[model samples]
Target: MESTQTVPINQKKTDKYPKSVPYIIGNEAAERFSFYGMRSILPTFLVAQFFNPSSNPAMQTMAEAQANEQTHFFVALAYAMPLVGGILADWFFGKYKVILYISLLYCIGHLTLAIYDHDLQGFTFGLVLIAIGAGCIKSCVSANVGDQFDESNQHLMSKVYGWFYFSINAGSVFATLMIPIIYAKYGSAWAFGVPGILMALATFIFWLGRRKYRKVPPSGIQRNNFLFISLYALANVGKKKKGESWLDVAKANFKEESVEGVKAVYRVLMVFAFIPIFWAMWDQNLSEWVLQAAKMDRTVFGIELLPEQVQTVNPMFLLSLIPVFTYIIYPFFDKLGLKTTPLRRIGTGLFLTACSFVIIALIQEQIDNGGSPTIWWQILAYFLLSAAEVLVSITGLEYAYTHSPKAMKSTMSAIWLLTVAVGNIFVSLVNSSIANKGFFAQLEGATYFWFFVGLMMAFLLVFMLVSGRIKERSFIVNEAEA
Candidate 1:
């Protein structure tokens, strides 16, 4: 095994992929399977196995809505916890230790769900642990993928990231299809326990690669960390001299580089402010869309499909669409004199996302009009949604990474993930509110979907205006170029 000090920040670039790459990618595939598998059935499990036990239709409807709200809250917490995980890894333990230790807790979360299927208190506790565990490691794991490469293999990093994303979708597609069937055929215990076992396997696979990894050590408590810089800037903003912004005041006590980095993050965050709404609409494919499927004719070509199982369409489309866009669509567009820029992709995605919701709202109107439309309507909606995902999500992460300052690279990843938390929380708030009361009470039935459509279109305008004005800032470059 290499010492903590063995790996340097700059090393010779190699054309060959690192041997550890396989282990890391493999770990991600399995880990994604575990994570998505558990969540795929979670909303249904909550509504059916626990919350909706009462026979009254009113009670059942309330239970269903509450289950959906709880599901979003769970997602919100899971994404929100990345801050804690990032802080611990950066300031105390390295990524490897934090991931492993927290993953053990993650396994316990699944076990709790499997063992206490009907107990709300235990179930809630289990979810909290899982959310924390998932959030804590999400950023670290993604960062670890790049840590394995240097200049020699730098070109291969993009390809590796592509494969990394491929593995994620592959794992999700399989889990989404399988887990619900397991629950319906056998029971919740097997459904939940299967993913738990996979998580254990993922941990073991990660551990097995210990000797081959180029382990990046933690940077002990530093004044340059995002929190420290932000706090210092806020505390001293009033002392700013002429020709200075609020953050510039911190330059008295902090390095100019650190202040610049903090300011860059703030600038990037302005663009990010509109992104949570994307997640708010996109994540509904898991909760609201699934519930919608329950009211549809889920049979196609003589085969019956479970409502929970329908979400497999999104990832399934993702597997095919990502490659299609990279090799065919992108090249074709380039030849036509329109290079596929990240912001362009994001803007296009925002529009398509709103279009997809319009489809969903239309379908809901059909259902409300006492029509049992084919599952293909939702499947069609997933295609547009999945395409939007390939455009927005994949491009957005790369955008976040490239734009961050070197000092705040990992911190930016966590902040990007925090957007998803914000999105889910927004959904939870809207779902838990509106309903039979509140300002948006009129936003019932298909009107709910239409509201999100308006939200997406409004942000699309903001993003186009903002993204056009900002220049790309690459932290992965030389100081002068940066």
Candidate 2:
């Protein structure tokens, strides 16, 4: 049990951070290294398993397309499971416990990948385990980071989450740079095995901080969570109290605060609805972008870069840009009489994403014309994409935490992650659709890139118009900072 000295974040009395903060940061770095290390090589490994790259040109094309589809499918499934993870942590096991326990399962998943390096069935089974294990802890980790402080240190929450994201990219940078080299030199088993070791180390680092942690115990097996109470309100609809709201019907069976919280979540979900379009463009970095790199001239300054190595710059850019945005760009914009509000920042990011895809589409056009574009073109695209990600992903995470009901932050974080799944599902569907013979099935290369560019621009226009309708409210966390 955590010390009785631990209190809910909303009730904290000090501006200083709790001891658990560094441990969370450390664990995140190691865990990201492990996750990305494995993921960075997943596409290459899948393609090798399914078909030889040295095969017929048409066969290679089909193989690459299928590999991209399966990769996104795995990504979608991994992200989708966070809802279940959120429910578990919010209603059964506490965040700390759930994270620790599932982390062990995550290690097992990595080990399975290493052991069954050449077996498709076993490798897929490992992906399922890893997806669930990774997905389950994702909500708990993000929410648990917030739960460490109350209003006393709420202002620091933003800085901490910044660091949280930094650690993620830090690890990703290391893995993306190193793992591909490992895969090239040592082959599949060692490439996957190395990440498994990092995961175990991540687990140990988390466990070491257990005693000093400010743990939030779960709301144990009660019929009082968001789902149950929302259903209760629906059943009791039209039986409302005279002066109360529609949701107040559930006040007979539950608390008024709980019902209002759900309403707030619903409103936030409206803003969230348009975000999948942004993600559809952003996550293509791993799928479509990597494949695009393979066809480009990797030589820059006489040093030939590996296709995967080109993406390492993304994390590197993020590392520098996050601080630049926080300390320079945003402050400069604010001084110039422009309010860099979260919604506005997100809108700018969406526009930038569309711009990046324009560059990508142009590159695809070159590739289709049998020209190998310089890797520098793709690098420039990644810069725009990275900047866009800093705004959309980081700002969105902080928004999800601060704007939603305090009671279900884990669930809210899970909801945010589910948007990624939704976006990837769209990509996967499009990927599979191309495999069939249809009008659009003939669409590949630059044509495919233009399709997403148009899609994103349409969504960006919609998001800009609708996001203004979202009524954002600040909670105890970071209230003073605003």
Candidate 3:
């Protein structure tokens, strides 16, 4: 049995890091730059850049749309597969081992894409491998941060998560700026190759932090956390009393440390149900959104911007806006006693997503009316969407970590990320159905996108209402400062 000391059996000693954090931040920045760089190029490459529309009459009608859908489907699959990877790491291989092996696979996946170049079969295989590898690393890296702290240094948890997210955005911003340039100049081979090299560097950095990392032994609890939680939730079904939320009953079953932890996990998971809808919309940037930009005149302020390059705008905004939101908006709200909890932030994010779609819908209306929509409209939408991402994605990460049992942290992180996978599936299914509908024929591109925008807005409203009822979990960060 665990004791009240709150220390795990195999916990390692770590310093309250002011400096070790920079290496993690730098590593994440480079890794994300590589991942996003390749991601930014995929849709355009698959669509007009690679596919031969003239040869396949059926494909010619909506080749770009289909290609975009495929991009989402594959990315979604990549995101989804990590659940398996996370499980394997937790139960068998251990996180460090999983991260190393999968990262190597990830590098290989990138290499396949670069080398296979013209071979469709080889390219698809490479993407799948890379996705799996990325999924594996994604599942563990954040949890690794948590491992670096213990009860004494737990105060630094917030700073660690902050830097973690900062690195992600930093990498994304660089990737956004550079990948498009690489694609436009050196083409796919070098663009994909660059990220491959960076993945290798990320692996090395993971080892560099090895001595400082907390090496908690596996729980040896044969029970699956999800199954256990599900049983507990089911037992209370239809047995409600006055003013008691399901979350309240769920929290009662957890041990003391996990009381707040369990509640946070449940709340995040519940909120997560609503997230896939937003992800469906957010992910369209590489797929449908970029395709839409293709039809627009790409000269912004007399500067030639590739349609793929425009995708970078969101990340750039994310990099700039995170600091603004963290320093300015979040504090401003906190000072006003508005209680900026994770649940509230996630709900607000859904609303912001709705507003983003509404803006996009307006832009589509302009195009339908024979008006040329300015690149500025898209930029405006990206700013709002990026803000929503900061609120949802970053908050969700911290929320997941705070809520999870120490032994199950990485698995829980994977569970939260799994929502993106669900959302991606929805994106692909919707796109495929719309394209297969055969309406508007030549105008299918415009028709399909507007359909998703409207649908996403409707879903967003539903999510906001559903999210409102989820009770906030009582919680505090437990890891130590160093």
- Which candidate should be chosen as best, given TM-score against the real structure? 1
Residue pairs clashing in model 2 are 9-150
The TM-score of candidate 3 is 0.80
lDDT of 2 at 126: 86
Top-down lDDT ranking: 1, 2, 3
| TM-score of candidate 1 to 2 decimals | 0.90
Candidate 3, residues 1-482, lDDT tens digits: the string is 56364556676445557444665676677778778888887877876556643547467446665676678888898888778776666677777777777878888888998998778889989988988888877766776677766676677789789879878977877777787788778877888888888887887876686665556555544453655655775787566567965544555565444434445566667767777887888888766677667656678898978777788788778878888988998899999999788878887887787677667777776766767777778878888999999998989877777666564565567777788888888777665664575433334534555666667667667776776687654334345421
Two-way lDDT contest, 1 vs 2, winner: 1
In model 1, the worst 10-residue window by lDDT is 3-12
| Candidate 3 RMSD to the correct structure | 5.5
CA lDDT of each prediction against the hidden true structure: 0.86, 0.84, 0.73
Residue 450 of model 3: what lDDT?
64
Better TM-score candidate (1, 3):
1
Q: Which residue pairs show backbone clashes in model 1?
A: 13-151, 13-152, 14-152, 14-153
Leading candidate by lDDT: 1
Over 4 Å off, model 3: 1-26, 53-61, 150-162, 204-221, 228-268, 326-344, 365-372, 398-412, 435-443, 464-468, 477-482
lDDT of 2 at 38: 90
Please, what are the lDDT tens digits per residue for candidate 1 over residues 172-236? Answer: 98899999999999999899999998888888888899988888899888876778778988888
For candidate 3, the lDDT comes to 0.73
Give the winner by TM-score: 1 or 2. 1
Off by over 4 Å in 2: 1-23, 143-164, 208-214, 222-224, 236-248, 436-440, 475-482
